[model samples]
Target: MGQHESNTKLIWQVFGFLSIVTIVEVILGIIKPHGLHFTNFLGTSLLNWIFIILTLVKAAGIMWYFMHMNHERKNFVNSIILPLIILIPYLVTLLLIEGHYIHEVMGSYINWKY
Candidate 1:
């Protein structure tokens, strides 16, 4: 059927997009650009923030197409997404703060002659 063909095409398109994003992530991880590594944002390197953001984007894309969330009502989608939107950043911020604190405390011991 024509509808089936179109759906198949759309699926392939989404698959290609997802693959490209994944490839980019892999390349970035392998290269580990020094600028990204050295530049700090939110108490962590820019590279880490980029990885986290790209991961979230991939997750959203997977949910949208594979999980059929795009077909759901706006209200329903918002209900499901809103809590995650609120929670993910909150958790990441807490993680960064705690991690920075721990690193700071530990760094002081590195140069001390025991």
Candidate 2:
């Protein structure tokens, strides 16, 4: 196949996959089944997991195809993604830990006041 034809095919493939994923996400949101309502993981809810996964998939599609990061130099890709990879986890952990501390303090103070 010619270069233009190959690129067109790849673009179509990505669009098709994203469309299917988007449809599924929408269906899941509308369904919102009972079992999925309260499912929890690592202090995060299952509905939260669904939203996070969908957002990450969208982010990956934008970064890889829309932004053309997949075709960029390896060093450039790493330069942009590495800090996000590192910082996101660090920030999440910091926020969760601080939230727990606040929860504990509030629980104790409320108990003492009553």
Candidate 3:
């Protein structure tokens, strides 16, 4: 049937898009270009920032298309997404702050042999 064919096409398209995003993530992780790897942004390496952003993008795409959020009412979608939008940044900020504090404290007391 035409509907079945269309569904199949859509499935393939989603699969392809997700696959491409994953491949890009993997390649970037492996290669870790020196410029990106060395640069710091928001207390994290540029590479780490890229990974986080790409992960969010992939998650949003999956939720919107695969999980059928796109068909839901605007308010329903906003209700679900708003918490995540707020939480992710909050969590990231906490992580960076705590990590920096730990690094500073450890550096002050710990001696390196190397």
Candidate 4:
């Protein structure tokens, strides 16, 4: 009972932090500054880079604190995270390639003529 209550309080703290991060992300999205409009590594825009880093930070914090991954055993933690690590890059690559294909198709083949 005591331990449960302690964990409940910790969960609330994590939720609060998550909420704050989400709010900041929304604000940044709404108030996008010109300074962050430049392209950086791999041609990813600076604004997109900011969003990606912040999103990853929020994800890691949630998984570590809210999901209690930090308290799990070594094998348990690796089993979940290692698969995600392997899959995310592949997913991103597929998305990027498909996006570029869509862009080229729309730009070249989809001529608006009536």
Candidate 5:
């Protein structure tokens, strides 16, 4: 009974943390501060950067707790997470490069009105 109660408490705590982070993400998305929304960093707006970072944090938390990665060996955890850590940046870089190329190519021909 005690163990069950403790597990329930832990579940609630994790739920609360995840909920708070999600709420913050949603609020920021809706109310995008002008300062953050306008500033560019690494070819993306600061607000976008914040969203990416918060999403990563939530993913890490879910993996560590809900997926029980925290109990695994360090090497095992690294093996599972390292690829994701590497893949995201690589994919983002690819996306940025492709988008820039497309923009440049289209700009030459389109004469965008806006």
Candidate 6:
């Protein structure tokens, strides 16, 4: 019974943390401060980068807590995280390259037509 109660409290804590993070994301998206929106980093706006980073934080938190990754062995955690370290960058690079090519080719037409 004590263990169950402790687990329930932890679950609520995780829930509260996730809720707060999401609320922050929503508020930032709505507010879109000029400084963050206008500044560019790596071809994307700072605001967009913030959204991406916050989203990644939320994902890691979910995986660590809700999926019980925290209870897993160190080797198991490394096994999952290490591959993503390589793959996520590779995939993002692909997206950026393809998106840039497509934008160069089709952006004018799409904007004018629309």
Each candidate: RMSD: 3.9, 5.8, 3.2, 4.2, 3.2, 2.7
Q: What does candidate 2's lDDT look like per residue over 1-114, in tens digits?
A: 665445777788889988988897888788776667567676655775676678678778878997999889999999999998898678766866787688788986665321
lDDT of 5 by residue, 29-86 (tens): 8888999988989987788888888888889899889998988999999898889989
Worst 10 residues of 1 by lDDT: 1-10
1-114: candidate 6 lDDT, tens digit per residue: 664446878889888998999999999988899899889777667887788778878889999998999989999999999998898768766876787789789987887320
lDDT of candidate 4 over 54-102, digit per residue (tens): 8878988988886889989999999998998888767766776786678
Best by lDDT: 1
The parts of candidate 6 lying over 4 Å away from their true place are 2-5, 112-114
Lowest summed lDDT over 10 consecutive residues: which window, candidate 6? 1-10
Candidate 3: tens digits of C-alpha lDDT, residues 1-114: 664435678778888998999999999988889999889888988998889888998999899899989889999999999999999999988988998898788987888331
User: For every model in order, what is the number of clashing pairs?
Assistant: 0, 0, 0, 0, 0, 0
**Candidate 1 residues 23-99, lDDT tens each?**
98999998999999789887888989999998899999999999999999999999999999999999999999998
Stretches of candidate 5 exceeding 4 Å from the true structure: 1-5, 100-114
Distance from true position, residue 105, model 2, in Å? 13
lDDT of candidates 1 onward, in order = 0.89, 0.77, 0.88, 0.77, 0.86, 0.84
Instruction: Please give the range of 10 consecutive residues that has the lowest summed lDDT in model 5.
Output: 1-10
Candidate 5 positional error at 90, Å: 0.8
Output candidate 2 Cα RMSD. 5.8
- Model 6: per-residue Cα lDDT at residue 78: 100
C-alpha-based local distance difference test score of model 4: 0.77
Clashing pairs in 4: none
In model 1, what are the clashing residue pairs, if there are any?
none
